[model samples]
Target: MKSKTKRLFLLLLSVIFVFNFNSIKGTAGKSVTKTVRVGYYQNEVFQEGASDKAVKSGYAYEYYRKLSEYTGWNYEYIYGDFVTVYNMLLNGDVDLVAGLAYTESRSHLISYPDKPQGTEQYSIVKHQGDDTITTNPTTLKGKSIGVLDSAIKVALENFLKEKNIAANVVTFSDYDALLEAFDKREVDTLAGESDGIYDRSHAETLYPFGETDYFICTSKDRPDLLKELNEAQSQLFLEYPDYISVLRNKYYPESLASRAFTSSEKEWLTSHESVAVGYLNNYLPYSDTTKDGKVTGLIKELVPYLFKQLGYETVAIEYVGFDTYDELVKAMDDEEIELAFPVGGGLFFSEEDGMFISKPVISTLTDLIYSTNYYDNSKQIFAVNESNKLQYYYIANHFPDATIEYYPSIDACLKAVLKGEATYTTLNGLRTASMLKKPDYEKLSFRQLGYADDMCFGVKIGNEGLLKLIDRGLSRAGTEYVNNLGSVYSDDMYKYTFKDVLRENFIGAFIVFLIILAILILLLLYSVRINRKRIREKEDAKREIEAVNQEKFVFLNKMNNYMREPINNIVSLIRISENMNDLTNIKNNLAKMGSFSKELTTILNNILNISSFESGQVKIDDSLSLYNFFGKRVLIVEDTLPNQTITSDIMKKAGMEVQIANDGLDAYEKVKAAPSGYFDAVLINVDDRNIQGYLFIKKIRDMENDIRSEVPVIAITADESESGKEKIIKSGMNGFITKPYDVKAILDKLSGIIL
Candidate 1:
């Protein structure tokens, strides 16, 4: 009886355990069972020009929402630095990263989806606080600049590679906030695009002088997933109706149904005579695709039609996606993206390459996709490209309550949404519609916001041949593209309906579009404008180097002329007259001589810069920022007092207040006791018995348990060498302040932390 009773209990327990396990799965329904790990640059902003103070948004937000919708997967968003994101991906701590620009350099490090809904443009935003002239990179020589990401850092460094300029770059993960700080004059210049576009896209204050493009990128670890995305995207673009609508919504929403054209519109189509065009990817929306899944979009529809009208046969088109722009650029440095359309000129060159501008294409606007259950939450979450700054600011303005997460690329961002990773995501409109038509989109819906810029095709840096044609073609056929879009959609949705408008005067619009396409032949009429040879231009391609060498040559000539004077003076004083020299007087002469030589060297450098600037061929260092520091108080601690009082008075005159220090211990004690260590900084002289300046900084670092201890330090000394500087820096000083320094250097160092 006891054995039978025990067997019954055991069976009951087994049944209970299974029931609980199955119960959990039943609740999930179609949702993914596993937890998805997502990583973002927590500092990245969702809206353009907005900061962390704002909400989550941009292309990243829409893409992820779509992902969650499709997969029913739940995700944990991990926010941190680049290393943190990348390391997590490697460790399986993160299953995905989205909204990153796809490039060859990044592909080597991670996997990527084959589809790219669209490309991105970067801008250099300047603040109204500082002197706007200083906003020009060319004017900034020795200054501080703020930047985000290693890629941008490298681009800045490469830009100023040969220039003799000094830039102290401050990095941040969220570029939008950084720009806001810049507008507030916090960082000298924000080096990313968010602020840049806000300034440029508007008319009131911000000015964008330069721009670059970013892409949707990801790791290449999962081929199967990438293949799915690749196929799905291709199909998304091929849908004719969506492609036409995207153009309408992006560039001509007011004329969404209007087929009307001005006289200039008639001349736009005849422009693309004999062209070369390239496609960034083979994904949907940007290219044409079929039911089986292929690449097709507004670009694809327009490329062939435009090419045929350009009076060209068999236009050579290349399929070089996000990853290949660089390699192809190396092949076409003065060469083009080998693609033709009315797009921005700078697209052909990566942001690092810095090129020109093109006409215009339909704006590629991204939308925020959300799960059905998401809006019910009091606070929405936004996803965006971690590297995109402008998207952050715009998002913040609209969704005030959202928290943001950064995804590496657009595909992964939407994937996060389809998998239910977040409450919101920003996505391309055409893509959202096409994806919705799919079986997966049943769980997703697109929240129609405003529109993005007119998306365009790309060409080489200096190629006006194709650009002129595109502008003319676009000018003429643009109305038709708009009209056609109207015809493609239902009357209710299409509003103006291209068929009705075009039918009224369709032949006239087409004829005008064709006329402009024919007139593009004049861009090549080069007889009036001869290629002028510039002696300066030929040598100025590498400006700094030639200038420095020229200075060296001038120095050698001076040395040759003055070589005998010092020796003769010495000999004459020693051999003949008592009046010729007093030992003390001789020492004074030598000191004065050394001082003059140093001044001369400094003056020469200043002269070289003036020369570079005058040439009009000199490129500015992208990394530099012009700053001003005056009337600031900095702590000075040394084992000795100022005997000369010369350095102190000079520092005071240069707009700085100096705190005196009689000993190392006194300086340390004084700095520590100050309210919150209220001093701007500590400048320690390294001439003590045991407590030298270098060691003093190290000790302070060790004492720092809170934010106060993280204060900046500078070792004021005469030792400036590779190893010596390294040792000094490692000792925990923010940097070095050379001894016998001029008032300028002192003021410059203090400017960074204060201003």
Candidate 2:
């Protein structure tokens, strides 16, 4: 018994110590009372259908009553007008005050819950039959306006003064006193709380104005308690959603009540007030960009709605590159963007958002396209939008084993396939269909890759409130305004080029294929016909035709020979003229003789060649025979600065095209630049300076080379140098000139050199 007692005593001591330790840690049995002091006007609306009949059913009492039940704590109502509540909270006398507006000054006195439970609008109460002030609030300027002696009334007066509407503010004892004055027409526009106005609407005589929300005010000393109250208020909101629903309806009277947010969204709103979004620019046609570079399209219209409904005023849209669109979504695993519009991109690769797509998108239309050429290929690799995995699954179910590579934008996907880099790409059906109006329309044809789906801006899973807000705003903006922006950017984005639309379109392809087939058949037939015709022609009229051609060649050769000798001889004659006398003495006489000879020759050659060719006897054989050298001294002439360039190129191709002359004077310079006895050849155009080739050659021989100033120099010219040989040879040249020359005779005389 003694041992058992000792053991029991020790065990009891351990249990007691553990219990006391837990109590010291504020855990085991401690109940912390998070006091939320509810302070508002001791009015009927606040006390609601309830514990006190004096207070009517309104936000203050109804909200606090629900909050008390939610947090298992009672709110001690500090009933008063503005001063009693403000002073009580300011002096650390209470924890929270209701029916308050957020203010810059008030922000320092309290820590707000980051999001408004809702917004507050106002009503302007005035005396009945007061037509003057009802027209504009400006009539109140410098006029006495009765205000309840409250902080809100002070703020209202200050707001009116800042707007340049001055008012003589009179402090009334309570809302009842303010109402009584308004009935007497003693003040201008009377300011009333929206809730107060809403509450007073029940009374028969006094008129209530407009409607708005009233906020709960909290004290600086009890911030933790304020947070507890806020959390309790949140639970109250979940339990009695009608409280927020009524407020929502008052603000958006035309809007329908939306389903409340799940617990997750409610939790998110308590933490953050802004959202981050994303856009991918490359997906054209379906989704494209604007000039100032903001996103606009079916999806863009949805983002503003998402933000407003979630109570976020600011949005940061990340214009992420297409390659990184899905990567940004992976950040949602880390909550990088609370909500994003994976945007007007493909729907085959990134659809995790679809798993949670509680919101409805307006439309979805898609098409599949492939290379127009190489018809047998159906194994296609497609560029899918990797960000929307649900969308990816949605597409893959139809085309299993269809290799889908993730692409950031639809534009990138289309370009990849159009450029023959990828085998296939899918674009929106409406986007693809309307693109046919663009010039590039014929370049591709796409039936529905499948069907269209409604497109909405996506939110990372937890942002349900914002997603719903987007739906609301979109419904407000309507589809017509939404589709108009789509048309403009689409016209700008998927604008097709001439080649893009026309090249390899149906008609061109058929023509090209038929032409290839026809050519192949013609080649086979021509091969059989070629030999028989060749054999017969060789044995018969081939020789006769050859003879006729040979004769024509000889006849032209004779004509060239007849003219060559005299021009050469005349040039020789002129070379020795300097020996007899000065050129100044002989210039005019020589010029006359030379000019007369040239005129006679032009008339003759033109008559001969032009008549024969017109008579159809002359036919040119393009057959060229290669030879090693030509010995004739060829003189080449020009009236302007001539170049070694033509000479060098011809030398490489056929050994020195001809000698170059800069001007008639420079022709003489070229002769001067050559070595003594250097020129064995000469070919000259009549345009060679204004100086005559006759004069040039005469100068060449007179200048004296060791090869005998008399070496045969042949003149080639468009000009006809047609003097008789005796006089010409007697004067100085070896030749006249040939125009429209034969390649063979020119070579004959040139290579006729013996030594």
Candidate 3:
């Protein structure tokens, strides 16, 4: 009995020891409640109000509360305006203050943490749909910029001075006042911190600058408190690597509200109580109506939501359905409907058609539906629906040679192809996806046309105010919701049964069987005619080979003659120019020599191009056009006189002042003597026997003047392979143009490098 009592006592002592150990481990590296006086200010979204309210809410508030888990510090909040609170921190009234932008002057009296709490960046924001202001800093000239009287204002002034932009800086007491001035159109733009502007979905960031770290600052005398704060911050980061991002996301999630309307738009909205919206009744999954007259589809569902977001009552929208696009458009034109639904396009409605369009809600691919029997038609014929003008126009413009058969609808168009009246039809792959699954279209297949059909709303012309409101609402609806709504309406994939396939392809299969049987019967008689046919074929083959060889011989002969004439003319011109005493005539002859040299180069390049084609080694694109380099100057370095003349003439034709340097030393000396930016670009011949191209470019790159060293240099070479191109780039040349380059090729290369 005594031994059992001792065991029970030991068990109780062990439980008590375990509890104490856990308590110690839980409080490891944490202090008891140390009341730290924190200076707080209303820095919207970051911190707000005084005492308990400031400590309970905001990004900084959350950060401090999270930090307290480690530091075990309870904040004694001292509330005041921004300046008063900051001065309190300096005067030692408060131990620390959050949201102080770090500066050299602030660092003298206060100590900031080694790592910043967060970065505060400022931007110039303008109202959404304001087209007068732009991202260009110069656009701010003579404009009034509203700024909260804080560090953001100072940053704006610095930005103006640095960019040499002269603008009126209108200061307000707080962010609310600044935003009010902007909403009243008293200022063209407002400068605000990122956190302050994050929730204002109506404001567009015109220019972002003045990025600086905001720190939790403390007095220099309180090193011990600062150390504890810094250590706690480090511990918090170590525990949660994404703590800062989490706090920011929690506080500043993107707002779904649409931008407020302008005064004119508001007035227009007040006048119009309801809007008549029309849709194509047959365009499925995008726009359609039930037999009961209830409009239902992916985009139809989105329209009411858009109105709701735009602050318009959904009941005010009256939906009307039309069987055809033409009918819908007519209704819109006749004032029967104020807007049309689900107009598919890269452009929904053209201004030329007297209609305005809103932003697209969803986009789908365009595809060609063709018969499986004849993949390639001998005579191309496209079936287009009268309702789908986009498809008809695309077919007409892209395949002008193909014949088109008009139908009433996409269904009729596809049926015409099945009946063999038309070879194919183009359509939106998404809207007709359900029809494509049916047995009627099982024999048809889709080929992507590499075009997108962005479904959008359309309205009549002179209704831009309404259109603007629609666009604003659409923007607020967000892409995710629009895409998810589309997914919800997407039909499941239809699996075809064996019976369905057989029933659909019965007639075509039977016709194919007949053709196969006829071919088999014809095979029996083929042997009898084979011997005679082979004899004739042998003779024809011999004649064809002889004709091909003759053609080749003639082509080579013509090319040889063409090459000789240009060279002979160039030699004669050079000799004649040397003998001429008249300066004008000499210059004219030199120009003729340049032209002849260019012709000779073209012939040689053609020969190389032909060889490349036969070997399938290269294909030169000739679509590039010569870029204008008017008022620019260029230096041409070449040992060959003909090449120098050709390149110089090319540059001169491009309206550039050209200077010729025959040798590397002369070229180097001219560049060294010329002022910075004097020569726009330099063309160096890589095949120069005297000066190595790589070494010459290296010399230019190593010039004493920085601007001169970085002048655009283009290498001229015979090699066009990838390895050769890489080697040229590695040799310090900006870019390289191949030998025998035409005006387009040379100038395109020059413009890319120079510009």
- Compared with the true structure, what per-residue lDDT tens digits does model 1 show for residues 321-416? 332333434434544455532223234222344433445555555676877755545657777655333345456655667788878655566666
TM-score of 2: 0.29
What are the candidates' C-alpha RMSDs? Answer: 35.5, 35.6, 31.5
TM-score-wise, the better of 1 and 3 is 3
Q: Which stretches of candidate 3 lie over 4 Å from their true place?
A: 1-150, 153-196, 201-258, 344-349, 377-380, 393-402, 490-755
Top candidate when judged by TM-score against the true structure: 3
Model 2 segments beyond 4 Å from truth?
1-273, 284-301, 305-322, 343-355, 370-394, 401-424, 433-441, 471-481, 495-755
TM-score of 3: 0.39
Lowest summed lDDT window (length 10), candidate 2: 199-208
Q: Give the per-residue lDDT digits (tens) of candidate 3, residues 1-755.
A: 99999999999999999999999999986757888989887766787666554335788887788878888788888887677777888899998888878777778989998778887778778877788777788888999988876667778899999999999999876555666687778988888776775556567776586888888888887998889988988888888988888887787654212244655577768788888888877666666777788887775678778878876764477888888777877888899988887664334235545577778877767788888776666878888888766576566656779888889878799888887888888877665577787777878888887766667788888887788888877777888898787666656323343321122233355346436534533442353245335546688576654553454345446666765786677667667866878876766666665566556555555544433332224332444334557779999998754456556755775678999887767787888899989999888887654756677788888877478888888888888899888988898888888865555676677778775
107: Cα error in model 2, Å = 60
Candidate 2 residue-wise lDDT, 1-755, digit = tens: 99999999999999999999977888646665554566656543433332344535554555556566656665565566666667787787877776666667777876565435555444455543454554366776666766667555756756676768867878876665676676556766566554443323212112222343456666788766667767877766676667777754544443111222344545655565455655454444334466677665544555554455444546544443233455546655466655545443344333533323433344655667665752226666776655444346545766677777876555556666666666776666556655455544346656664465555465655556655556555655566665665666565554433231222143344345436534543543453255335546687667755554444344435545644564455455455554656644355435443543454354344434433332334433233234554442344554422122222223333343356664445666766766655666655554333557667667767864344455455555554444444434554556544555443455554555422
